[model samples]
Each structure stands twice: as structure tokens, then as C-alpha cells.
Target: MDEQTITGSTASEIAASVRALHERGALRTGDALPPVRELAAQLGVNRNTAVAAYRLLAQAGVVTARGRAGTVVAGVTAVAQEGYAPDSVLRDIGTGNPDPRRIPDLSGALATAVGRPVLYGEPVIDPALEERALAWVSADLPGRPVRITVTNGAVDAVERLLAQALLRDDAVALEDPCFLASIHTVRLGGYRAVPVPVDAEGMTVDGLRAALESGVRAVICTPRAQNPTGATLSPARAAALRAVLAEHPYVLVIEDDHFSMLSQRPYETLIGPEHRRYALVRSVSKSLGPDMCLAVAATDPETADRLAMRLSPGTTWVSHILQRLVLAQLTDEAVLAEVAAAGRHYAERNAAFAARLTERGLPTQARDGLNLWVRLPVEAKVVADRLMRRGWLARTGDEFVLGERLSPSHHLRLTVHDLEDDDAARLIDDLVDAAR
Candidate 1:
């Protein structure tokens, strides 16, 4: 072979070719590639050469290795390349998602949001949405000063807040067994996550006091309807938490009120008036629809402006259309009524299942959320396996753990909705047997 042909045979050459394809939009992330053996044979190259190229690409974060599923491209905007393909066979039990049947339609409201698209560098946020959101926040936190800015979602809000307030390696207090996204967001953003213990009352005041003592700059909490465990912060617990936080006014508090519209529980914000700095991220995903991808970030004006600076012509802005649509849904009396009804329905159904477990001597506790946290007599992992064998899927407690090496409480986080009597009876029977 000549010099040009010899170069093509090198692994770096293959990698460079792949990189060029990606740059030209031919090789995109999330796209599946042929198996190494097959690809090598197709390219008339040695198997080792192809393996080395794939390895190099993976090291560069250009591709991902899906065990038993083969290699796939890993880059930005790879809708065509990766994931449990739009039509994959695996049953997804790991995704902690809501039932779409519950999310109300907003076709009519969306029609109002789509006006003439603004020109380049034009403000992406809707003025009408800002006005309505201001009114909404005023109702929630009367007499307390605040500012509102719309974001793509709760994750976006958290990311922006951390970006503005923290530098790499900064410590932030997060609930132990925290929402996976919250933990991941902090860790990925180069901030350290300090575990704050959680109990039935929600995050313990002791935990907050300790985290502050350790010099955490920020704290992220789910004031009500905590994820995974789904526990609401009791008013007494909130007061205690505020008492501890008041001592450290400089530590920014971020309360994610994710279940506001979907929970029948009373509203009690933990950020006391005296605690000068904090932000509240409220999203409609759980209450409305996941596709909405909209959240309202209410914070002090300085923090608001920092967030706005990130949103201004210098950075990406949330869609005015989505904001307007959310505003329309919020202002509509009928939609509000429907959402309230959905909230009650979720609560009632979930509570009913918990009651059934309680009646069976399992003694499940009733909390305010779309899911229930049930404590089994044995280890949760074993119980989850048994449930899976019986054609039911449930989340184990160990998955939500943080820094501390505490034994799991034999607890199962269950989502109860649209239950069939036979399946429900079978699951309860299996759980009873599993517990024994």
C-alpha cells in the first residue's frame, strides 16, 4: 500500500475521519453505529484497528458503549443516534415519569401564544407572561418582596442559580437520598454535594445547621412533595428549618416547589421574610404536562437580574410561546379547576393504595404527593425483585442514597395510578408474601 493508503489504515486516521463526519453533521450523537467486527469487515480493516478507533472515540466522549446494544454516537443534538430507540423493546421501569393521560391539553391556549415570531436579539420572554407571573407570585408570598423569571424547567433554574452563585468545588447542601437530577446537576456543574438528612418532617433542622457549619454556600430543598420519597415538610419542621437558616442569611436557599398545582396540600414557603436571599422554582411538568418544559424562578432582584443577564441577548432565553401558553393555562378558570381535580384524583388514588397496604398490616403512611413511600419488613431490593417477578415494577430505596453509608430502610417508593383491581390485588398479595 502507498503512504496515503497506509495512513488510512491507522486508528488516528479513522478517528479523524469520524470527527470530520461529526463536524459535517454526518456522524451525530445518539446514532447507532455498526458492530466493530462488522464495521471492520466492511472497511476491509483488521478487527483490532476498528476496536482501537471505537475506544479512542469513547475516550473522547464521541460515542457511548451500550452493553449488548452496541456502540452509538455521543454528541450534542443526536435525536437520530442514541437512547432506547423510539421503538426499543426494553420495558422502561426506571424512568420515574407521570402518566400522560393525566396532563391536560392546551391546544386552544397554545393558539394564543403563537403570534408573529420576534426578530433576532428580541426579548425571548413574553411580557404578558411576566405580568401574570408577578401577580401569581404576589398571591403566593403576600407582603414578601420577590422577582419572577421564566426558565425552561426546574433543572435549568437550578443550573443557572448554581452557575451564578458558585464556582467550581463550592459546597452546597442537598437532601440525602436527594432527587437524582439535583445531585447530578450539582456534581456535573463542579460543585460538591453535602448530604442533609431527611425525615417524615422533611429535611431536619439539625442537618441544615450542620451543613451551614461545614460552610456550604447554597442549599436546595423540596419544601413540599419531595421527590422519590414524596414527603412534605411539616409547618413545625419548616419553622425549625427557618430558625436554623436565619442565622446564616448569606447562604442562599433554593426551594423547589414542584407539586404546587398538583397537590392538595396547604402552601407554606420555608423562606422566612427575614432570610433575605432565596429562590423558588415552580414547574408545571408534574402538575400539567412534561412537554410544557416551563418553570417560574422567583428570587431577590439581584439574583433575578443575574438570571436575566444569563437570559438576555448574551445567552439563551426561554420561549415566549411556551411562557404565554403556561400563562394562559394558569389564568384559565376551567384549566385551574381541571388541574385541581387532577391533583385530588392523584392524591385519592395514591392514598387508596397506601390505605390498602395499611389495612394489610403493612402500615403505610399517607403523605401528600403523586406517589407513596411504603416500608416493607425485609430489604427493599429483595422486595423489588419479588415484585418484578410478579409482573410489577417498583423503585428501591438504595438508589436515592447520598454520602452516608446507612442501611436502606426496606422502603419502596411506589407510583399508584390507573390501577386494575386484579393487578392491584396481585401486587398487594405479592408484597405481603415478599414481606413475610
Candidate 2:
């Protein structure tokens, strides 16, 4: 082929040529594929088209680059995934805040989810999910100017939102000792974090004011069931925070209500319209089934549009099958009743556990949501370690700390009601010993 002739061909033609070369044993295993720029020059294709072709090959695991060795056929195989199981119970306590009652048997839906072969470029997400998600997210923010999008999970939504709103070295105000996932996401994105203090009623208004005054461009506040603490945003505090936020209307405000419908308390939206750039992320993992892995993020249209641009149905969209399954369960009156029942069941059980602990002289109190944030007389780590030695695993407050000073609260964060009766008894006994 003439050098001039080859350099002007389309990306598809170059790809075909590469495929033919590969099949003929001319390009064998461990052999370097042509450089993207060189291949584009030789095939007369645009550099971006060649890059795309290379990316497609990489995504298929057909080729991976080694430094200076060029892109070569990948020798390693991908690991197979084990089927998803509820993680709250392996020993059955102190993990996820899952309500066993919220999961409806989806035998029929599974058959439907499995019926068809999924084709490339076929919509990975169902249209019905978007429709129902619209109603679900906006239900609490009714008459407000916000748009909704369905993400694979709340973590995915949070990561993508942070990616779009903030860049490397940019600072965002986060709740100190924030949700573990939030801490991971911000640091992974290379953003500088400014931790604002939070208390029994959620993010402290004074701390937020100071952070804003320091010129943070983004703010992530959890309105209810603050992770690891279970604090909420009271109306008065929310109003006061809103007053402070009004001065910074242009800043992106993110309200992560991960424990939305499962909350024993009512939902109060702090991002009520008039704020220009705000997003509310609610996930079904805590309220319903964790394996469902779906979150609805409501935002001003501008942010939603940018997020939509970044998330492809193939790359990160929630499966249509899962979305349909969730909506079907959520819309069913019987299912809603069960979910409500689950909420009450969890609350009552957690209250009983708290009361029992109190009676045992450990002095723990139960609040809203699927977990209890317990106050301990001794260091939480010491208590948890003692419990582990007696055959229990639990999460300590230090795991949730986003602060630099290691302000370790003498507290243990535990999920309620996943324990067997004997296990619970043993736990209480060990806890009493640990406290004493």
C-alpha cells in the first residue's frame, strides 16, 4: 500500500486492516500494536478516531498498553464476579443498614430481566425508570425547579457530581467525619476538602458559614440520617443554613439523602428552589434492597445535563431490568406498606436494643434509620476490639472521620437487628464487659 494511500483511510478501514493482520498471525501475542498517532497517519484517519478505535479495543480487553512497549493483546483474563448477597449479615450485624422486609420476591421480574439477549448499543436503562424516578425524587421537592436522573448507585452519583463540579486542587465543604464513600470519592478525584463540623442536628450553620467564607465552591450536606452519627437537619437549623447559603447562590450544593424513604422521620428538602445549582441524591440501597444499587439524583437542569453527558448507559447507567424491577416494587401498594412496616420494625428493634444496652449500663440510645450511633464510656476502638475478640465485628467512628486531627469520638456505629438471639446476647454481655 502506498504511504499516501494508507494515511488517508478511515478509522474503520485501519481497524479492519489491524484485525486482518492479527488473524493472519502476522501480529502475534506480545507483539506491540501500532501507535494511535502513527496508525492515524498511516490510515489517513483523524487522530481522535484512531484513539477511539484503540479505546474500544482496550474496553474489550483485546489490547492494553505497556510503557514504551505499545498496545499489546492482554494476557490476563478478567475475574468472574460472585453473585450479589446482602452484606449486612455475614455474622449478621454492624454492616449495612438493610431492611429485610423491604425486599419483595421478584421471581417474575427476574424471569423478565433474563428473557432477552442484550445487544450492543441497545439501551442499557429502561425508559420507565426515568419516568418513575422523576416522580420519586421530585415528590418531596414538588413545585420546585429541579430535574432528576437515575444513577447506578448513590456513590456513582456522588462521584460523577463531584467530577463535574470540582477539579483537582479545588476545595469543597464536606461534613466532618462524613460518609466513608464521600471521603473516598473526594480524595480519589484529587480535590482538596474543607471539613465543616456537624452535630446532633446535622451540619453546623456556623461551621458551614466559615467554610463558605473560606471560598469553597461546592458543599455536600446530608439532610437526614447523617452517616456514622444519624443526625438530621432540623427545620430551624436548615433555615439558618439556607440563610447562609443564600449569600452563595452560585455554589453547587449537594444534599445526599442516602437514607431517604427508610427514615423514621419525615423528609425536609434544604435545596428547595431559588438555589441555582443544587442536587439531591437518594438511593434505594438503604430503603429497599442493597443489591438494587439505584439512586435518583435531582438537580438543576444545567448540572443534570453535564452529568448526563458524562455518564453513558453502557459505561455507568443502571440496568433497565433493575430499574423496572425496583419501580414495580415501589409502586405496588402492598410493597410500600411492607417498606413502611420494615421502617417501623427496624426502628422498634433498634429502640429495644438501645434500651437493653442502657439497662446493661452501656448507656446507648437509638435514633432514626437502620443503624444506631452509640455513645460509649470507653474508646470506641477499644469497645469494638473487645467485641471482636468475643466473636463480633463492628464499625468504629474513626472509620468515618474526615477530619485531620483524628477527633475520635468515643462511639461505635452499628447496624441494628441483624443478629441472631444468641449472638445478640453474647454481644451485649461482651459489650458490658468491655464497658466495665
Candidate 3:
């Protein structure tokens, strides 16, 4: 048997050498590298240097470390489906984006951020933004000594939070019909995703218990306006989940409240007071706009420290200008009114579309969020194809499923909030015809 050797004096050099091997096709997926001590001896470096190199590789998604089995090249991560076709003339209702017209205008807010020139070594999070975010997130959080951090977006926050607490191959509990970005993040990080089936009232208690028993290190949940499914955690459901999580108080629990200000339902949390590791992430993407690219993460002090290590000075801090822009808009009375109206707009539009589908005997319900999760009698892919033929693009539920292969799904997630009444009716009629 031939042995694979990576040579470098330092951690960065060794990581770069291994990366080169991967890029050159010398190291394929699942191919194990030399043991840490052996690699250190072979490279003439200390053991800690080799370990640091491996850790850097794991964080970069280039390789994964399995406790006893050793580190190996990580698998290719799947990218989330976003945006639309440039050449297609179809009406794109598959894009999970908030209505642009409803997004608060930022021109005035940008002007207010020009008073001071922020330089290096300054605070990572904007002072005003941090104070406002602390108050907003603390109101719903149950724990004490709540610490707040800001990241570029909800996806960035979740990625960093998971990276700080978990190693590659560690099991993470996720909602079955998960968010696409979440699916991509977990897979790309070389982590195992344990599916916790989600129902109309949020994550099933039995599924959660099963996941906990399987020794999952972390659980990622969306408490309200769950993507694709549009399900909010009912009070009873939240309590049941909290009870189950109480048994495993140390498991890292992350709540992504992406629809924070835009959701019609009250915020329900899964973290209990005694739980040790937890983070609640709220982003302004839906309410303010995705382009703003900012989210506030309220977490336990220890978890905050771990996350801060990665977000230190020059590397990955969220821009102060963007943070200030968000704060300026958040404090404005007129902007608050617009955001409230936008929330109502999404709920009303989704509800109206669901009602239209129900009237046509399709029996669809848009519980919350910007999209409607419609069940079709046929497979979602087949229905999606038919809809495409009729000049419409809809996203199939299979795209959101996690695991080896996609399970049979007869659902289509359609973003119809921006559609006009006449257009929506036409799409509904077309959908009915296509499904039949």
C-alpha cells in the first residue's frame, strides 16, 4: 500500500499543502490522511501544530475528523438553489424572497450613518445596534446573562455557531423539511444531519427524543414561520420540545428566528433557563431586506466567547456602516410601521392564496411566512415540470429534504406574496390543471 504524506513546517503551510493535494485529485473524498502524530513526525513539526492544521482544515470544510477513525477528505457540499433563469420568460414563484416594494427604504438611513469614520480596533458590533438588538432579543429569551453578537446574516451566524461547538462527523438534529441554506451548511461542514420531522405545530416530540438519544451534539430549529412549511411552534409544542431538550441540557440548541419582526405569531423558544449552550438568531432580511445582510445573535456567555474568537478584529466582522443602517431604520417610527404593514401583507397574501387554492378543492393552507406549502396529489417534481410547461417555476419540497436520498414528496413550496390577484388566480388555475 502507498502512504500519503503532506509536508509543511507550519499549520497554515500544512493546510495549504493538503488543499493542494485535494485540488490536484490526489486526495479524494473519504481518503484518510496520516495520523496526527505520524504527520507531525513526518513533517518534523510538533504534535500541536499538526492538530492545529487539522482543525483549520475542518473549519475550512476541506477535511473532516472522525474521533477514532482519523481525519479524511470531506465530501462535496451541496449548494442551495437560488435566483432565477435569465433567458426564461416564466413567472418565477419559486424564489423565497420578500416583496421588494415592502422593504423599508434605506436611502435616508444611509445618510445618518455618515457622522463618524469607523476605523480598525473599534467595536465589532455597532453600539446603538447592540443595545437595540439586546433589548429586542432579550425580551423573548428565557436565559440570564444573555450576550449578543452580530454577523453578516442568519446563515453566517448559524455556520459560525455550529463551527464553534461541533467537529466534523458530529450529529446535528435538523427539521426534516429544512431550510436549503441550513441543509447546505450542515453538509458542507461534514456533519451528520439527524432529521427531526416537523409537523403543523413544529418539531415532533418523538423525533426530537430519538435524535437526542442518538447523541446528537446540536439541534438547529426555526421556532416561527419555518421555511418551506410555514409552520409555527404552538405553545403546547414548544413546551413539549423544551421538556424533551431538558433531558439533554448540554446539547447546543440554536433557534433561527429569520422572520422575527415579520412573523405574525408570538415568539416561542426551546431553550430553558438551565440549559447551558444555546443561541437565538434574529435577522432583518425579511423585514428590512436581504441586501442589508445583518443578524443579531443572542447566546450564552461561553458560546458568545467561542463565536467571538472566529469574528475577531480584521477577519469576519459585520460592517459598521451596514449595522448603523439597520439600527437607523429599526429606530425610525415610519420604518417600524412599514415593517408591521409588510408582515400583515405577507400573511394576508399567503392566506388569500391558500383560500383560493382551497376553493378550487386543492386544500392548501398558508399558516405563516411568505410562501405557501401546497400538497399535490402527484409527485412534486412531476407537478413542477407541468407548471413549468405552463410558464411558471415552482420549487419542489424534495429540494429541502436532508439525508442520503430524497423521500417521496407530493408538495410544492410556492412564493406567491408578490403576485397580483389576477396572476395568483391564474397560477392557481394552472396549478390545479397541472396537478390533475
- For TM-score, the strongest prediction is 3
Candidates sorted on TM-score, descending = 3, 1, 2
Worst 10 residues of 3 by lDDT: 77-86
How accurate locally, in lDDT, is each candidate? 0.78, 0.75, 0.89
TM-scores, in order shown? 0.78, 0.75, 0.84
- Tens digit of per-residue lDDT, candidate 1, span 266-316: 666678877777898889988778778999888988888888888875258
Taking every candidate in turn, the Cα RMSD to the unseen true structure, in Å, is 9.2, 10.4, 5.8
User: What lDDT tens digits, residue by residue, belong to model 2 across residues 1-436?
Assistant: 6322223265555556555666665666677777888887766778899876766555445567675778886655533111222443334346655756556666645654554555557655466666777777777776767777788788888888988887666788999767777876776676768999888888998999999999898998888888767788888888888888989888999889887777887766567457889898988887567778888898889998898787675666667667777877777787677777777877887888889999988777776777788888878888887776766667777767776654556878787566666767777787789866
The lDDT leader among the candidates is 3
Mark the 10 consecutive residues where model 2 has the least summed lDDT. Answer: 79-88
lDDT of 2 at 230: 78
Off by over 4 Å in 1: 1-95
Clashing pairs in 1: 30-81, 30-82, 31-81
lDDT of 1 at 24: 70
Assess the local accuracy of residue 53 in candidate 1 as a C-alpha lDDT between 0 and 100.
85
